[model samples]
Target chain A: MKFLKIIFLISITFSLYAGEYAVVVNKKNKIDKISKKQLKNIFLKKRHFIDNQKIVAINVSANMPLRMKFEKSILQMSREKLNSFWTKQHFHGISPPLTQSSTNSVKLFVKNVDGAMGYLPKNLIDDSIKVIYEF
Target chain B: MSFKLKTILLVLSVSLIPYAVIMILMGSTLKKEYTENTLQEMQTQLQLNVDRIEQYLKTLNRDMHFMSRMDVMNDIYSKDLDKRISYLLMEKKKDLEIEGDFYLFDKNYKIIASSNKNILSDSKKINKFIDVEIISGFDNTKIGNLILDFSLKNFTKFFSNTKSRNYYIIVDKQKTLFLEKKFSNALKVQMPLKNKTNIEIVLQEDKEVFQNILKEYEAWFYTTLFVGALLISLIALYFSNRLIKPIISLSKAANIITNKKDYSYQVDVNSNDEIGKLSHSFNTMITSMSNVLDELKAESENKIKLLQEQSKNEMLEELSSNLSKYLSPQLYASIFSGEQSATLSSKRKKLTVFFSDIVDFTDTTDTMESEDLSELLNDYLNDMTQVALKHGATVDKYIGDSIMLFFGDPESKGVKEDAISCVIMALEMQEHMNILHKRWINKGFTKPFKVRMGIHTGYCTVGNFGSENRMEYTIIGSTVNLASRIESSAIPGEIFISEETQILIRDSFETKEELKITPKGFKRDISLFSVKNENKKTNKIILNEKGLSIVYEPDLQDATTKKDLKKTLEEFITKLSV
Candidate 1:
């Protein structure tokens, strides 16, 4: 039982560690690293358009706690508390985001796409990626 | 099928109808109360939340109006019209420190200036993002318009004051502000319920409420159910024991009385209700029934006792009355016990006995009124006894109208002329009986009575006979029986006697020669003669029967009851004449 508890704790810790997230843009994008205030506004969908282009956001798998942690960290709130906000948006026809899994996949997709933003851990950052904000 | 089960079923049916009605009313009231309370609470909460959101909207409107009146945008519009838009945008960003981004648009809806330094916009950034409602604020015939984007980073901090509450703001331009993380993989966007509508315009804030609501819903369900069950139990207990109890008791008592035939039941009803009244009435009815039954029982007992007493009296009367027909040896003692004490002793002495029969009565009564004939016979016997009592002799029982009387039975004197007096009584009885006999003739009854008598003197027993249980008040000896045989042998209306009687009265009466009769109970043929008159005057008579010679007294032949001898002589004379 103790071993099982240890395994459970380890998995939770790994999940927590895995969700260390930063907002990234394309490597060739002209806008430099933004402040946390601007990043929060973009990620929370306060601004759907930036730099004359529609700002599209990406998401990750729900059961992956890493993805949940990324959402909580970057959005700076609990998932349940966040859903209540979006549920209100459903009447106004404002959806949250198009989502994907794995930091590498999000990075590759963001590189090819314009005005795309998403979160990945710093460990997943590579030379082809541009870090826009961190939480 | 049976009475008791049917009775119980009837009670259950009546009880259930009202119980069902009460239960339905209880359930409906409970449902209505709970629903009204919950819906009112939810509606109040929703209104409060709506007021909170509208307050923020008013604030935004006020802030926007304040910015519209600012001198900074006016300074830019007064400068070179094309050059002033950029300067107005830069200055407006400084003045509106509450909003992070700023933009300026001319009448054509084109972005005129940029605040951020980058290749940030493929086109103009801010003007395209503003809603028509905001644009109209600047559009009402003004020089130009300014739009500002408020900072969303501090949104979570703004909502922290609410209790377990989260919120998001979205502009009409599709700028979304969320203060919480969101679930992405719900196949459908099923917002928690509020008045059957999704909690729109604040998606993330509404999702946080559903978990608590689900718990609250479950708790309210269980709690209300528990309370409802308890209330129903209390209701059932109260009415079943209180209201139904007395009625049930009354019903049971009634059933017990009806089935067991026990009217000894009572009910105690303390309630001042209908059931109590019913109990009181039931008790009254039972009391009445008990009284009636008691009276019936008493009357029945009285009738039985009275009948018993009447039968007892009848039996006593029958016991003492004599049978006038024949000597039924049975049932004679009860009558003989009532006789006077002077009638009996063990030592036998001389006594005179008489016997008689209805002459040819056996042939005469072939068809007759049985009751009339019996009444006629009783009357005749009554007159004969009255005459015998007058003559100081006891009238024995009769065979038909054939009566046997005796003197000195019960009371006899020494050598007194008792046989001659018995002859005179017999003559008077025949004379008196003509009155009753004429009545019999009018009633179409034809029967006649004639008597024959015999007398003798001998030593005999004169008392009751047989035993203490059964006896006859009679004289019995060989001489007495000989007198009875002589009477049987005589013609109707004649008297016969033994030689013994003639010797007893030989000095005072006239006698004829006696004929010997070897009849029943005689050792040899004894000489028997007849007696006629009360005073013996003549003595020149003798009996000659088949060459046996004996003396007879002339006083043995009666003047009236001796008509049979005259008839026989007349028949003889007639035979000679014919």
Candidate 2:
């Protein structure tokens, strides 16, 4: 058991230096390098139109690590806070972003849809999607 | 009931029966419609809520799956990733709009991160695993469990349209999950949740909605029925009055006519209906009755007048019969035969008048009993009146025991014959006095009652000579006075005649004595003569012997009567000699 404890501690210490995530948009998008607050606004549906183009925000599943990192780093909100915020937005006829099951699907949605934005690990990022921000 | 009331009730009932039945049917139908519509509306609302809940659940599942696949899940093995996991959980809670905590646990069930920080210290076991999702690493290896405790509050807000109502999601008889508000009593509607096992949503409905709808419909039903009944009753009353008023008035008029028995009264019939015609017929009956009564009254009056005339005729006949004894036969006959009128007018005519009376009647009455005296006087007067009527003299009147008679007035032979008749009547009356005297002697009256009479013939006023009320058919003139004067001067048992009467009867009668009678009303003395009839019975021989006197009528020229008389005389003389 002591050995197992030493192993668990080493594994936890190694996970602390995990790699960063990236926020990507469609390759055809005109603007890049969006602010963290603007990304948060996009996900919350507060700023649907930017640069005269309708934006479509996408999200990963609730239990996904990349989505958790994106919520903490870019949106800077917890799961409970987003739930409450979207519920309030629903009263004003607004909706949260669309969701995907995997990082590859998120990348594919961003590649296919105009003004689409999503987050994924840096390794999963491809030429089809343009990385707007990294958090 | 009165006619108007009956009529109104009849009409009202006729309309009200069908209307009430239709209203009842309509009310029931409306209530059925309300119930059906309410059920359909509740069903639609329940379905919408069910759709919303399913959609929310789907979103939660999709989001949890997406989060599990993120590259940030690699940080799960790192000791410094607890804050990051906690923040991610909190974000998920906010995004899902839940009032519940979220938890990230390691493979060993040890809590790693949670949205509610206080949940880490509590050793209490979880009430349930509402949504337990797997959290995976970047290599698709299982990392931990992601749990979400969903609050029913937001779903309750979605279905909060019903207040004072309750909803429960009952998993068993005892375990119930309240969706909106907690309630003890409820109507249960079972709803199945999508992609769920052995779980159902129970929708509860309050009875208040149905009750309110029924109350509104009831109000409308009663109001419409009441207004319809009132309007129909008013119309019935109006029409009934129009139909019944004339009949009532006609009945009143009929009552008046019967009670008063006045046929002149007329019924006021304004309309030309059957009642008006009846009134006209009644008026005709009264008129006919009144006319018949008038005719009966006139006929009765005529009968009464005729009876009165017949009775008056009977009375006059009786009076005239009694008066005929006072008038002379000829005068009575002439007046009754319409030959003479009873006007008080006198005419100058030659008449032979006669007067007669009892001589010393006062003296005889003083000596005799009154009854015997009246008897003897009636006997003498009866015989003298017989002799006067036998000579055709009109006996005018009798003043006590005296008589005045005239001839040649109502009926006459001639002036000369009238004088002769008057003289003969006077002479016969005097001769009748002798017979009456003998009759009185046999009646035990010693004194003889003698009568004196006189006759005259001259121009005299005769006929009805008195006033209109007491006119008498009598002679009144110098001739009448002269006859009265002659009667006064004559001796008892004698008749005197004036010169005119004596000359008229000189060839028929013998004069016994002559005298001058100057009456008080006469201007000159009237020569009167005591008269006897030439056919008087003076041939009788009277012989007195002893105390007896005998009277004999001898027929000497007849041999048979002379022989018989001689034989009787011889027997009487021989008896006297012996």
Per-residue lDDT tens digits of candidate 1, residues B1-578?
74444544555555555665676676567556655654454455545555554465455456555655543343222222334435544565565444455555444544544454331443444433222222221213464555554454423333432444345555543555563544442111112223213233342323235445545755775676566555655664565566667777788898999999899889887987877888988899999999999999999999899889878867765754544233322213323564444233345767777776777776665565577667767876766767777776666666666777776655544434555455455556555557656866776665655666677766787665666666566667886678778877766665676777766666545566546778865678777676554445456453322223344455677887458767876897798699
lDDT of 2 by residue, A26-109 (tens): 899987768778888888777877787777777877898778888888778989998998899889876566666667667765
- Write candidate 2's Cα lDDT for B139-236 as tens digits: 24576766766565545655644674544565544456666565454445666666653455666666555576578779888999999888877877
Compute each candidate's TM-score over C-alphas.
0.36, 0.39
Question: Which number leads on DockQ?
Answer: 2
After superposition, candidate 1 runs with Cα above 4 Å error: A1-135, B1-165, B169-179, B183-226, B237-261, B269-285, B323-386, B389-578
State the fraction of real interface contacts model 2 keeps: 0.00
Candidate number with greatest lDDT: 2
Chain A TM-score of prediction number 1: 0.74
Off by over 4 Å in 2: A1-135, B1-344, B348-354, B358-366, B369-371, B374-395, B407-459, B463-474, B479-578
Fnat of each prediction, in sequence: 0.00, 0.00
Candidate 2 at B505: error in angstroms? Answer: 13
